[model samples]
Target: MRHATYNVNGIRARLPRLLEWLEREKPDIVCLQELKCADESLPIADIEAAGYGAVWHGQKGFNGVAILARGDAPKLRRVGLPGDPDDSHSRYIEAEVGDYVVASLYLPNGNPVGTEKFDYKLKWMERLGSHARVLLAEERPTVLAGDWNVVPEDRDVFSAKATRHDALLQPETRAAYRTIVHQGWTDALRALHPGEDKLYTFWDYTAGCWQRDAGFRIDHLLCSPEAADRLRGAGVDKWARDQEKASDHAPAWVELV
Candidate 1:
């Protein structure tokens, strides 16, 4: 099986590119983040016509997530992350497809440190950690895939100095991400290309970041032990980012035997 994760930025605006990508890549399962459209506005017809069945949790004009399976609909598991009743962002969605539990998440971008947004980002990571513990205990084949909004290490970005003060590169943020990975999840891309540098999935739109190859590895696919056992290959679809009017993010994928 092949599974991929992509942060679409805005599904509506990127529908054409998304459709083109689905046709070319033909992944068995896809996790999408940052739909930036409400549930009612999701382009279900186009997605269905592309021969994929999808389940999405959408919010208006901002964060959202979805899972799509080719040939059949994904069995819904959870629509939102647990441990926070007041939290209303549509940033998480999970489903089961052929015994594998897959999740799409859009972690908060906590910019401008020393603010409530940053605090919420940390708290949200804590909740995710708690919930992830439960999932790990199950020992089922699982993949948590999407834009984590985190630059895990200095090597994951083009220049450590450029992003040193950014929230994604903050020590606290990296620590939270590490805590989750320490729970036995395999970072698929890193596992496949251990010593490779400048392998990135996201590039900012401004300052010719993509042209200059100044990018960041924020989109990830984290596989549990059960799924990791079947890991066959992984890669970033960098071509997608080079397309006309493309999203800042490109699809990152993993193949399993």
Candidate 2:
């Protein structure tokens, strides 16, 4: 089966593009982030018509997430991430699809270095790490896929020097990401293309980032040991980013045996 993750930026505005991609790629399951629509406002009918059942946690005009499964609705598991009762962002959603426990997350974009947003970013990651540990304990096939918002390494970005002050490239952010992966999850893309130095999943709409191929590998699919053993292939759908009125993020995907 094939599983994919995409940060659509705004589901309302990007539904056509999204549907087009779905028809073309035909992944068995898909995790979506940045719906930017309220729960009631989601285009559920259209999605269902496309032959995918979905469970979504949407927030008005901002963060949101959803999981889509081909031919059936995923069994809902959780709406929000654990460890923060008061946190209201619709950034995480988990569900059971077939034998896999899948999570779609939109980690905070802590821009501008010294700000509350940056602090929240780190704290959120800490919470994610703690929760990931619990998931690891289950020993089930699990896939945590989404726009992680962290560049992860110098090689993951087009220009490390240009992104030094960005939250996504911050040392603490990368460290937190590493801490989670250290709990025995495989970074799918890297596992398949370890030596490819310039693989990327996101490109900014400004500064001709896409045109210049100035992109970053922010979206990721981290699979637990059980799922890792089935890892067959992985890649970024770069052509999707080149489409007209495209989202800044392209689809990142993995195939399993």
| Maximum-lDDT candidate | 2
- Please, what are the lDDT tens digits per residue for candidate 1 over residues 1-257? 89999999899999999999999999999999999999999999999999999999999999999999999899999998999888999999989998999999999998877788999899988988888888889999999999999999899999999889899999999999999999999999999999988879999999989999999999999999999999999999999999988899999999998
CA shift of 84, model 1, Å = 0.8
- Backbone clashes counted, model 2: 0
lDDT, model 1: 0.94
Q: Name the weakest run of 10 consecutive residues (lDDT summed) in model 2.
A: 237-246
- Write one digit per residue (lDDT tens) for candidate 2, span 116-173: 9999999999999999999999999999999999998899999999989999999899
Alpha-carbon TM-score of each model against the true structure: 0.99, 0.99
- Model 2, which residues run further than 4 Å from truth? none
